[model samples]
Target: MSKPTLTDLNAFKAVAEQRSFRRAADLMGVSRSSLSHTVRTLERRLGTRLLHRTTRSVSLTESGERLLQRLGPLLGELDTLLEEASSHEGKLTGRLRINGSEAAIRLLLQRVVPQFLALHDAVELDLVAEGRLVDIVEQGFDAGVRLREAVPKDMIAIPIGGDLRFLAVASPGYLKGKPILETPGQLALHRCIRQRLPSGKLYRWEFQKHDQEVLADVPGAMTLDSSQLMVEAAADGLGIAYVPESYAHAYLREGKLVTVLEDWCPHIPGLHLYYPNNRHVPPSLRAFIDLLRE
Candidate 1:
């Protein structure tokens, strides 16, 4: 029997891991038909059925499972060794997959990405902007950026940005007839624009004044999933929006929105870049982290 080529092995791995020809094709940057053909050719060469394919799903056969169990770790180690060797040569060249929230992506694009890419042109960055927190390791990401409080305890985390504050803001038109919102409690009396988290739960507005902290489940007439849309809604006289200060900055500067409870909006630990502690840190990711710190 002829030996299976690296392309065939990689195609098999991608399909087996993803369990979907469509998804594997998307990740591999190849057509679904081509990926399927490659896997079939691999199976024929090995003289065994490696996968159980159905219209709706794909599962590995016993042979495929055994092969994956053996090959996965070996391939991972090989990739790591190659990355380390390249790093020693002072040439960082590899894909760095990052999962980040919208706000984190904004900060990375504005501060780190451009400079990092310029310094290491061969490195490919795949930035996935997700609204919800994801398990980076399980999702096949090299690292993730999230609010400091949201990072998992088992991961190694490094703060990538300064402290961030959340502000309660509304348009002048919406505030005209409303009573002054001097305290967080006053939010209940006004029409609020609430934010819905990725888990489909409403995010309680949080505030702090000196030693006192207030978490208000303020009632609202409108709820949105995005901070940018919330700012736009607040600017359009919808209701008060509790958003990160950066998201509302332009509106505040343009006089489209006014802030309340400034004293309570204390700065908190900001975005952090994190990865699993047990994994070998890729040189590309390490370079990016160092750039962020600088």
Candidate 2:
């Protein structure tokens, strides 16, 4: 083609982001020489130097500054539109990427995912499930699912799941003869299964009674990063696990585990799907959201 291709804009964006051809090359999965040649080709077509280059640094020229300022967003939006169209098949077929916690995924997938896909049979979903909170914009995710407590104020949050309750539970084997903790203060004396958060801090046990809320830094015999692990540990009668009620459902039904201190645990706002306020709401995302409601 005589005209520039999308690859050209992508190369420009990569170079601009890194300010180094070598770094851009690594990011774009291309050789340094190839990146250099591509930039040279782009400059030739544009008939101006877009970058001021030195041995150790690269910055935009006057012309480059103007172009970069305007080009960056325009190109990004173009890519978004095209990708959305392709992913959604112009709202006829589509694919969606949802970044979220594993627990959140497990909680909603059974009811929401299947119905949403069935309604939009052409829509495909790729779930990025991790406990670590991710920046959806920086990571180029279409949308993110997170608890309302963690969502940023700048994003638009649509509540997808109802109120979630924390349940303090242990195996019948573990709770036998243990003094029941009727208050939040007493949890400190118990051997609780703890969750190590991404911030390198253990999750503070949270409790609510009537209109009052409490966050307790409890001592633990064992701490794990994953909720699944904590549940397994609790099932083995290792310690009392303060976990989401959803995770304890099966055990609660089978009498393997029993919930304790029900009155102390309060209902908290649940999961929500969030997206950048500045970003165009893609049809695919809308379709997926509707599925969550169903």
Candidate 3:
């Protein structure tokens, strides 16, 4: 059998890692049929079946698993070497996949992404913004952005933003004639725009004052998942919203909203960019981390 082309090997690896032809093809910027054909050709050259495929699922055969175990490291080293060699010319070229929530991605887009892209025009950034936290390493991402508390303990984490606060805010119209909320416990008697977490659970509003902590399961008729939406809901006089202070800044300035429990809204650790400690850092990812720090 003739030796397989590097393109074929890379295509096979993509499929193996994604475990879905549709997803792998999308990642590689190729059509599903084309990616499937390349992997089949690779298997044919090696005289072995590499994957067990059904309509809804794909799994690697034993031979395929062994091949992937050996090939993953070699290809990673090749990519690192290629990126390093390219960097000698004062340019960087590679793809970086980062998984993050909407808030974290927005922060990067505003602060880090523009500079990183300008400095390394050839680097492609695949930023996946979602509500759920994922295993970045298992999902084949180069890094992940999350709040420091949510970052996995085993990964190398770098702070990307300053401390943040979650404030209880309501429109002046909603607060008119209502009893002033002097403490978090008073939220039980007031309407609140409830927050739904990524895990499908209602978020309990947490507060801290003088080293004492309080968790309130706020009552309300409305349940929203996004902070921006909650802020809007509060502005519309639907209910009070507990959200990141940044989301309510404009409303506060315009007098559309006011914050209650000001002293109880304590600063918390902020966003972090984290990556697997054991893996080699790609040049583009390293540059991104550096830019974020700056």
TM-score per candidate, in order? 0.90, 0.76, 0.92
Q: Compute the lDDT for candidate 2.
A: 0.81
Span of ten consecutive residues with least summed lDDT in model 3: 134-143
Q: Rate the local accuracy (lDDT) of all candidates.
A: 0.90, 0.81, 0.92
Query: By lDDT, is 1 or 3 better?
Result: 3
In order, what is each prediction's RMSD in angstroms? 2.3, 4.9, 1.9
List runs of model 3 lying over 4 Å from the truth. Answer: none
Q: Write the per-residue lDDT of candidate 3 for residues 1-294, one digit (tens) a residue.
A: 999999999998889889999999998899999999999999999999999999998899999999988888888889889999998999999788999999999999999999888888899899999999999966778899999999999999998888899999999999999989999998888999999999999999999999799989989999999999999999999989999999999999999999999999999999999998998898889899889878
Q: After superposition, how far is residue 162 of candidate 1 from its true place, in Å?
A: 0.8
lDDT of 2 by residue, 1-294 (tens): 256667876787678767888878975679988887888788888888888889899887888778777776786577567766676444445457788998778766876887777777766677878888987775557789899999989999989768899899899998888878788788777898889998788899888888788898877878998767787889899998988888888988999888888999888889998988987877778777776666
Superposed model 2: Cα runs more than 4 Å off: 1-4, 11-72, 83-95, 119-124
lDDT, residue 167, model 3: 93
Model 1 residue 13 CA deviation in Å: 3.4
Ranking by lDDT: 3, 1, 2
Is 2 or 3 the stronger prediction by lDDT? 3
- Candidate 1's TM-score: 0.90
